[model samples]
Target chain A: MVKKKFAETPNFTIRKDFRPLDVKEKGLVFVGYEISDDKKTMNQFLHYDQLYTIRHGWNSPFFIGLLEGKIMGTRCPKCGDTWVPPRTHCWNLDCNLQRTEWIEMPKKAKVHTWTVAGWSGRSSLKRLPIILVYGVIEGSKTAIANELHGVNPWDVEFNMPLKVVFKPKEQRIGAITDWHFEPADEWEPSPMNKEKERIKKLVEPVYEWVKTLK
Target chain B: MSRKVCIIGGATTPFDYGPTGFESIEGGAAECVREVMRDIPDFNLRDIDMMIYSHFSVHFGHQLSAEWIIHDHLGLVGVPHYRVENGGNTGGSALYAAALAVKSGQHDVVGVIGWETMDSVSQSQGSEFIALASDIRYELMVGGIYPIYYAAMANKWMRENKVTEEDVALIAVKNRNNAMDNPKAQWYRNEHRYITVDDVLNSRLISYPIKKYDCCLMTRGVAFLLVTTEEYAKKVNPDHYVTIDGMGLSSCTIRAGDRLNFPGWIERYGPGYPEMTEFAACRQSAEVAYKQAGIDNPLKQIDFGEIHDAFSTSEAQIYKALGLADSENIAQFIRDKETYLEGSIPMNPGGGLMGYGHPVGATGLMSAIEAYYQLAGLIPKKHLSSKTQVPDPHTGIVNSHAGTGTSISNFILRRV
Candidate 1:
């Protein structure tokens, strides 16, 4: 199998300055510089940077399946239990570390829970007011969290039917982000309620705030 | 046979210490030790047989093995020490470790010191760092920060239990209002001491249903508690000590999805058991603690509580898990003012995490200290304000939780 190239490594620089040691004693070195304006209340910054290569190990199949437009989960053969975001082994005490086998899950799912996230970590800020849901995919015993598109933040409801939409195979990488959920074609949002209006009002300011961030 | 343990005394740096609180982590820790020593008469650093330190994340301070520096700074260079880290339950876990040492006759006196320096990074970056606590491969990849996770739970919980946005906002208002009486509360440092449900509703939206006011502050502070054997407690400040009667620690799956349709959970807890909406770990921990403390009904037996209200929604769900209110009547429980200062079960009288500020590592110890003060009848003395003091309280519960109720440590303290 050919090694798939990921994104380019971003270039960055670290600021550093050297100064004579203030201590009278010898054999001492300073690695941090004061950043505070007040001399009495000294604050210093020490630069830290590193790159990590994490392994999926036994969970690699789950990510690989995402790239192939398949939702793969694990099943405890002994107990006939299935899981999405596949577990390497059954967590049940009765199963006692029983290794699970991979099983293909259906694209359809039900929204077990959801949130219209107005803010997010720095990387995903551009996707503000995004609807995230923990959906129990068909044939899987556990739910998997992912972004839900094709619905307004206020229109989301409990037990909403959804179907997974995978990225085009050419654009797919072996990651959970390879696919996202969209409202099933047959479903329609209910008429807005007082609660939905309240949420809509609450989320309006978030869009304005996110604009300022840009 | 095990010996009983007691919290003789403790002290904490103001929760709103902010970015420039101290020059270094060691300085902040030493100050806490000094303050604690000064608070307890006849107690000195030399009397501490062992020490346990709680610090949540090394990412914030950019330092590892910080307990070693803290121990050396406190002039405890030769003392045996251990460090405990359990996301947000760091402080409670450290206290539990120290109490076990005293109870099992391993040590006569154990000191629990905890601190967190979160001001080292910007608020956005801090959220990113905290989001890393979630399952990086799955949850974190989808931008699962705490507010989003809690908001999802809040959404489901509110829908299932008929809890409205106003009901959740009431908790924010109450806790922030309660903070006015706590000199060390972060709210005391802010310009706005009083807030209403409308104010909470108007705050900036963090995640849908979770506004800025609903969240706890990122704090930098230190706290230390001294745990001693029952006999040693009598020799020390016996008149002002609270016994550690019962403790319970429990954990659940780090991924919220695992809790859904968990095998045997429904059979054990009935329908909706182990639902992602409620904290099963919290309920389990409370049950263990109540069983040990001989508490049949927490609402009737416990006088007050110091809850880990990372978000207003969490506090309401915790009240149900702690059995302070029934699940069906939770919204009514809050509407009836059952958790107010003058109510039957006053909670977070010293301003919980939402008001007190959560320094992660020190938050649980702060709760424990608040419980200690309440049971020892020193709230007015310690807080310098009598407004939050429970009326002659005899029993109190201190709860410290992490993740979406992934790890929980609960303690039941009683006046001896």
Candidate 2:
């Protein structure tokens, strides 16, 4: 009879010997999700210079006007509603809201609510410094999420007065460029959001824990 | 417990695993059924009475593959045919279902068939498809693979007492060597000896504790059995017959995610997770089998047998669950070569799903076939290097479990 091998390969083997290992006691699931160490065999590695064409239209001055500290938005002459960040089309389904106006307005709004992430992979924000906020401008509001700087993440409250703060270009990524909400130092927050009770009951504890990283 | 059902007739196609370029699943199933029909000159195809088909990947023919296509393929069109899908346990469940129908007097004779094809579809997809047997919300959604299913057993089994991955590897090596004697097995790829524990440790990781080698390969093939009463058996095959002596089915947690924690599950099932536990879906089938057969102490009373070694861990647990391993010296049992074809209780003598090529429906029936052979002394004894071989003592059993956690069927086949 020919000697056939059914279970012997470096990558795929079944041990016949009766020795043991202490792997299972560690409480770690045997398979790792991420390939932990770079086991690439060949030496060439990847290069980055081949892709820069998409970065050219990045920071035009018209886009920089908001960073220059003046109020900015896209205005509709018909409904008198101010839209910022200038979307190309209107969301008004009733009257065909389209991108038809460019206008300027005040930069202030009131904070509706916030949350701070308690955990992170990096030693970031000193203490959980990220904040998610719902801000209302003249007649309209949109929820914007960003990291809170300078102030404590846990101290943020609903209905606190706020203004947009844009970081310097040298430290920013070109996409979703720097712009976050900051609270006015003296204005205390009013508990007025619609889901304020549930929000307070659920989210604030996490927010407080996050503030300690700083 | 109820009276045992017997296999009057059975058939097989050349073990087609679809992508293996053998016959397709339906073609293989039809061939097996046709072979059975040929053996039983008096039995009529239209009078199949009821139908139970098993499948790993129905691909498109899930229910209709064995039922619709098989009916058309074998020329038995109008009878009701239902497909059984339970991952690796389907074959065992298929046989159990057919047995139950025969015992219930639902039909004079029922055909149980199963098949699987892994070469055409990607292994990950095939596995992901079977992973559906686990709870979607918690365990699977968390990216747990099949080996992890048994790895948890390996972990707890080790913590509670002592069983290592190497012990599992020893079982794997044994199964592979056993498959060498079986031309019907799926592990024709390599010799199991000479492999070391370090090899299993270094294999590609799928889930912690489960490496690529620690898992079974997905093969393509079809297998089936015909179940009926003693009267029907006498009518179909008057000369050859094997009765269900001590069958047992136990349920385990089908989906592990729903429970508050995992340990709550083992409390009901005992050693082999849900397969032996009251929580398992196949509990009724097992109870009826053990009671009808009058087997109160399975470990001591029953002799050599086969089981659902979907993973090597399962084999170990069943060793204890059935009370065979003696617990005090299980390692000595394996190292001394006790659990082999000549061991005190030889399990999965057909190579098990680990090496037999787990093609769903065919696995359980295949185990049944092995049981029938062992009962009749058809199997070549322990392969003493191919040329030298001899037979061993009698009394055999085959335990199979499916993915559903509910479909477990343990079969006890004996020679008169």
Candidate 3:
């Protein structure tokens, strides 16, 4: 397969602007400028508006499996260690970077730990009060992180059983968000503890505050 | 054996500079360099044999190869120099590298200059840039910002250790209150010089268990430290210097999830241990440093500590890692005021990252500078106040961590 040139890619774009601003402070200059020998030319801010084209490279199979409604992981042939969010090579010093083989991971997992995020990076700010969890899938030695949904954030619990829920085929983008975790058939949130109650009290107000911003 | 390395002098710009603190990175760095030169007797730029630049991300300033520009501006262009980038550990890692250079006899006197100008972008944009430091493919995709990542650990740790939200808030209160005595602390410039634990509990939530006050300020500032061999240190300032007794650096998996049921968790920490909640790298780093420093009991042997409290939760976790407190006694440790300036094994008397602004590259070096000043008994003279100084401190430890303890460096400094 041939890759498109960056110039021809749909995600590539450039933004340019030039404006003068007041420089009142003796030493605080907004932009750094360099002049030519003849003092004619100068330089200022330049902006690049482009989306990165990051390839999965050796981990392509893992992403490919996501779109196919299956979770893929890597297994070390030498040591029999399994990894989700798969690695191309074994990380163990004993294995010595041996090439790893792909294996289909079980859809079920147990919540190792979690947090209810009231704020996030700019892109995910709108999805406030998001539940993020690190889940250890069955038959895998390591855990993978993803969003947890279908249950109230306050109701999330440790060691909760969960099953992977993939986005519809048309909505799939081969990204990690292509799937998320939801409560398994037999799982239920336990009664709230004092520690969790405190978190709930702190986080509830944030939801209201976020609504005001929106 | 490597030659002994000592920090003879150090200086830092006020952390409240905000973004656009100076005309350029060079301008900010030059100010710090000049301050260090003036602060240390008979010391000047000419004394710096090599320079290690600690800078975190190029995304902030949109500039690459910034170390060269700062190097040229400092009039040390001919000297060997390179930049070190390790997320939040940039400062400590750079200092570690500089110490090695001095210890190996490659350079008798080394300078570690660290700075970050983060106000170039809005807070949200800055958060986005910082989140990119995580494993972008897995963690960042799931909306994992620093606060959220730390909050996850906080939740598990708090529940297991029986630590309350109020207990975590006490850290914010202690650090910020301590900051009032620090002229360079960001909190020192705040309208409200002191905040109560209730205020922290009521503060807006960034992520569950991590409130607004619990977070460190995204700052623009610079810190400089002069590390040299015993000969050079004695030559410059014989009366005021701290010897680098022990330094240890360690790293772990960048992805927090991978630590779950970690390979050696049960063997190392005992059965039924919550692995991801603890900072294993921090413990490993401190273990190495303590061993080398001949410290059998850190809480009793070390006089004080300047910890990497990127979040209040991290500080609590680090207390256990540094052997200051254990899981069962951590909450009680904070409640009993064991971590305050006047307590046994006082922690962060100079205001930690929470109260002191956190300019990623400069933060670790700032902690080292505080350790140096405290050990040398220069707090009252240099900071213009004795409120934040530990009494007759002979040993102090500085910890710098990055990426959810993905990388951690611990240094034990001794009054010489």
CA lDDT, every prediction?
Answer: 0.85, 0.55, 0.84
Report the number of the highest-TM-score candidate: 1
Per-model TM-score, in order, reads: 0.93, 0.58, 0.91
C-alpha DockQ of every model: 0.51, 0.02, 0.52
Off by over 4 Å in 2: A1-214, B1-4, B9-21, B34-47, B56-66, B189-203, B257-288, B326-332, B380-394, B404-407
Question: Taking the tens digit of each residue's C-alpha lDDT, what string does model 2 give over B1-416?
Answer: 55558866554443323333344556677667766667567777766788888775554233334456665676656777787766666777777778878888777778777766554444545666666666442234222245544443344444344565567777777776677666656665433343455666555433323444556656777776788788877776766667876666655445422121223344544444442211244444555666767777765566677677776666665565555554576555556655666665666666776766676657777778767756655455322243112144346677777653445777777654
How high is the lDDT of residue B64 in model 2? 34
- How well does candidate 3 reproduce the true complex, by DockQ? 0.52
Q: How close is candidate 3 to the true structure, as a TM-score?
A: 0.91
Lowest lDDT 10-residue stretch of candidate 3 chain B: B16-25
Ranking by lDDT: 1, 3, 2
lDDT: the better of candidates 2 and 3: 3
* Count of steric clashes across candidates, in order: 0, 37, 0
Report the Cα RMSD per candidate: 6.6, 21.4, 6.3
lDDT tens digits, residue span A23-59, model 3: 2334323455567688755545444444356767778
Best by DockQ: 3
DockQ-superior candidate, 2 or 3:
3
Model 3 Cα lDDT, one tens digit per residue, B1-416? 77999999888888864533454678878888778777774987887889999999988777788888889888996899999999888898999999899888899989898988787677888898998999998888696588888888888898888888889888889988888888788888654378999889888888777888888888888888899999988887999989989899988778887776555555566754437788888888899999989998998899999989998888988998888888778889988988888789888888889887899999999999999989999989766488888999999999999998899999999998
Native-referenced Cα lDDT, model 2: 0.55
